[model samples]
Target: MLINEGNTNVFIVTDAVLNKLGIPAKVTDYLDAKNISYHVYDGITPDPTFNVVEEGLRQSIAANCDAIIAIGGGSVIDAAKMIAMSQGNKCKPQQLIGILKARKPSAPLYCVPTTAGTGSEATLGAVISDDKTHQKALSIDPRMVPLAAAIDPIIMKGMPAHITADTGIDVLTHALEAWMSANASVETDYYAASAVKSVMHYLPLAYKDGGNLKAREEMGIAAHYGGIAFNKAGLGYVHAIAHQLGAYYSIPSWSC
Candidate 1:
């Protein structure tokens, strides 16, 4: 509806995860009902690379998209951030890595997370891989955060059991690491603790029954809290080492 108010030409960023599960139907339906034109770039891999970002950008530009909607797991969100950032800054994904190098704001970004992990939809950073070596790169800028998000448990209901378990642990890890950070302020600690409590109470339920909308919704909220907490407090050794391994292994951020 927000997109409907504007004459927005949208680029849909996602991966095989959502496509296989047919989660994009609602999105297409909403856009179609509004007579909105869109292009789907469902080519994102597990750990997105510079090439992936470039490919997405190519499609976006080809379609003359003015906005983006990411609709899958962490990798999908990460790729969306890179694609949007590249579109706005008019640079390669490799050029934007490390700290805040973005000279301008990214295209208006939105997310519809299919998994309650990474919380990338709410974060200011995206981890992208190199085009050549498959090594990871960190692109951090305030503009990378999505302007809005859709955490619909109905779409998240189709996640596999293993993914549900892994992503739930990912949420807990984010909260735990944030709570243990040296810069943990009262505000951040509160968010971290709340996220931890929510994950403890709801993750198992969600894992056991992916169809449980209440549990799925709670986990989604918890993941968001963890993202906010970490963004404020900063993580410690675990995240540092994990980042290294993730870069070296070229694995998904959630797995790390």
Candidate 2:
């Protein structure tokens, strides 16, 4: 992902998981080579909370970042979306919940997915947690979609067996749920069916051997198709129930 600014800095919001996975260093190396000024806030937790979004917003503003680049899994990208949109809204992140009206637009945003699930890079929605109410809050706006997305297979190669299994299930859920949604159209169904077939054939292989490039490539394409399907057709009960499970159990949405 490239963030262009005329002498202004760029901000990155990411989860600690990607730091542990050593992806951030790679990104920083490239930024350094390009002489880009940047700061990384890697404190975003799993199933990000409103406070987490607020913190990232504060950091982004403090750094005088004109653009935002998010690198990591869904949580990181979700947090970035919240941060980017919250720039002009003076209200707290929790206050923005259910208030679709916007006073100002957000900064340019870019995404680099380190995992093959969630597909937050391609979607217009960001799911955040209201820690006070113990409920999940969703922010949906087309402006929240990243201006660009970088899907490099090398970034997904480090996924462990458990993450691979869970994220693969997430890919399947996106496809199936989109197919069953009330808004599904002919184009949505075609993409959803293709995603289903690809996930069914390649998820297990990718999970079994993380270094399998062909399987990883297939899985990546499946995730993109699933994203496109759901982005147009919307999702149904499976996602609703899964969100409940994540909120109730304090687990990752990709996890059972």
Best by TM-score: 1
Which model scores highest in lDDT? 1
- Candidate 2 regions with alpha-carbon error over 4 angstroms: 1-7, 88-91
Cα lDDT tens digits, model 1, 1-256, are 4565484688999887677777887898898998888899989988777788899999999999999999998889999999999999988887898999999999889899989988888899998877666567888999899999988998888888889988888888889999999989999999999999999999889988999999999999898999999988887777677766776787765677
Model 1 segments beyond 4 Å from truth?
A: none
| Model 2 agreement with the true structure over 166-242: per-residue lDDT tens digits | 99899999999999999999999998999899999999899999998788888877887898899889988888887
RMSD of 1: 1.4
> What is the number of backbone collisions in each predicted candidate, taken in the order shown?
0, 0
Residue 173, model 1: lDDT of 88
